[model samples]
Target: MNAAANAPRKLPGPVRAVGRRLPRMPASIAFATALNLTLRRKFPADVLDRLEGHTFAIVVEDAGVELLFRVRARRFVPVAQAAEPVLRFRAVAWDYATLAAREADPDTLFFNRRLLVEGDTEIALLVKNTLDTIDIPRTRGILRRVLRAAAPGGG
Candidate 1:
């Protein structure tokens, strides 16, 4: 394989700038909706209950976006910045994509400092362990699998 082909891709600066300016509500809504459709059923009800009223933030550094959400009524909902989040995850967009694609392990990323998880250690462990237990079905194409994993409601 060519070295260029193996190189990591980064989101363009202009695109990142646009991403930074994206309205938090809409982005959060989309993210929450995707999570609801894909991982909601996979998460145990008790876990959801435990997460209730707790806010979380995902900061995509390269994308220049911070998504804030809370679990309400056993569902994830977008929330405006009010108080400190119970947990905050920070990483570049490529790292996040690799995670979603299952091309990179979260534990490895965390240990390597490529992925940062802060605040409420117990809650962070709960979320991480919960996610580790999930098993998304494997599909033929990586992109297809990612898309299906993101929006499993279609299938």
Candidate 2:
């Protein structure tokens, strides 16, 4: 393993600023599309039914971005806003990446206050457990490559 890969990487301030200024709909759309493409088939029908009609928000603190979406027709749909979301996850972008990469455990992050979850605890656990059950092909490698490319002196 390369030393660069092991080093911590943070999004540049300018990049974060750009992320903050960017529109949410496009981001939400991309997020939903990726979710549908990668994890939709793995999700149980019962879980989908339970998730239906519930809004969710992911707040990226450092990026200053909030993605609002809901499960409708068994698909994730981006929404501009929601009065109240059934679940809200707040975390920095790197933390989210690490979580997705499985380099950092969600429980550790939550306990350390790096990842914050709000709203329905049961649903949150369901989501977490469901994610843990399925394996996404090349997730860690892909995320590592992406992070490496994004890092200042990396790649």
TM-score per prediction, in order, is 0.82, 0.86
lDDT of each: 0.77, 0.83
Q: After superposition, how far is residue 97 of candidate 1 from its true place, in Å?
A: 1.7
Q: Number of the top candidate by lDDT?
A: 2
Please list the residue runs of candidate 1 whose C-alpha ends up more than 4 Å from where it truly belongs after superposition. 1-9, 138-155
Candidate 1 lDDT for residue 126:
93
> For candidate 1, which ten residues in a row score worst on lDDT?
1-10
On the 0 to 100 scale, the lDDT of residue 73 in model 2 is: 85
Pairs that clash in candidate 1:
none
